[model samples]
Target: MFKKIDFSFEIKAIGYAFYFSFLPFLFFVFQFLFGEKELSFILLKQMEFLIVPFSAWWIIFLYHDYFEEGGSDLLYSYPLKAEEHGLLRIGVFSALYEILIAICCMFLIVRFPDANFFVLFIQYAAESLLYTSIGFVIILLTKKVMVPILMIVAYVSTEFLTEGSITPVFHIMSFNTEPLSLDQIIFSVLLNGCISVILFVFGHLYLRKKTDLRLF
Candidate 1:
């Protein structure tokens, strides 16, 4: 199963994604050098907000490569089943994304030893999966890379407009300031994880029945 993955492609993708993901951290480092101590907390919060959208955008952008003219034909002609290929692609990207998140959390933890970043890491994982599933469904249904990009823009816009809402269903950025209880963490994991599973299943089933590969 692992042999099917294009490690070169995955490595390049992860490199690029991490480059963008760490931009804010780099900025914070510069600020800290300039004696802005408070930026550390801000940097942590920035990562929490950035991880989902950045990972989502990267996943959607990478999907475009598969749909390019002759690339689509060649990719679809692979010996593996479509569902297997789809799942592998998602799994690889998701795994790399989580690894990047983990690295960021580790950096923050080293700088702020008292901070409980494990909770934030768990929440980020669930949110990342949620956005990835949403992106997968959009790409599968529309077969257009731009559609997912526009969908993300609209979703982010809506999220900004409703940032004050406490309901988790309404806002992906609903992580509270206080430490989350065990029950709260479990509820969040289950809610986002279930939605991710449902969307992935729907995308896989859709791909099984899909005939057209052209984006237009």
Candidate 2:
């Protein structure tokens, strides 16, 4: 399994994940040191959940681009087919980043003992999976190098537009203040899971069918 995989790219993806997870902490520190308005511990806690996974999506998109450029040619050349490659990529990239985000959440919740741990984890996990799918779709569709920049713009704009309320397409469940009922939380997870699976399947199909050597 490991022999067929591009382990170096996996390491690089984990590093990208860490970079994204670190940004919110840096922002919080800067806000605390410079700003006159005292922010609540809850707000800082919320920032960690909100920024990290979204940043992870950005990193995921970049990694997709890297792979598209034949960055990990060894995987394509090895005995592994596209499905195994996709599975390994998702596993390695998502697992490491999810753990990093989870640890960040745990540390923040330790500071604010009153926060709901399950709710926070569910929210972050849902958003991370959804954004991962979005990244997958972006990589599969656009051959242009500018797609990542456009994707970042689209993500921010969608968040701005859907700043409140839940939807099938756009919802920032991570930063929402309301404590969700069990059904709503389950629905969010299910929805994200379905989408991620669809995107992964579609991405693999795309790789198999689309034979544009110039693109991938």
Cα-based lDDT for every prediction: 0.66, 0.57
| Tens digits of lDDT, candidate 2, 117-196 | 78667666766776666666665577443575466556555555656333455453534444344566777777777877
Leading candidate by lDDT: 1
Task: Give me the runs in candidate 2 sitting further than 4 Å from their true place.
Answer: 9-21, 28-38, 41-76, 161-169, 172-175, 178-184, 211-215
Q: What's the lDDT for candidate 1?
A: 0.66
Across residues 2-37, which tens digit of lDDT does each residue of candidate 1 receive? 887787775564356535755655654554456455
Best by TM-score: 1
What TM-score quantifies how close candidate 2 is to the native fold? 0.69
RMSD of each: 3.7, 4.5
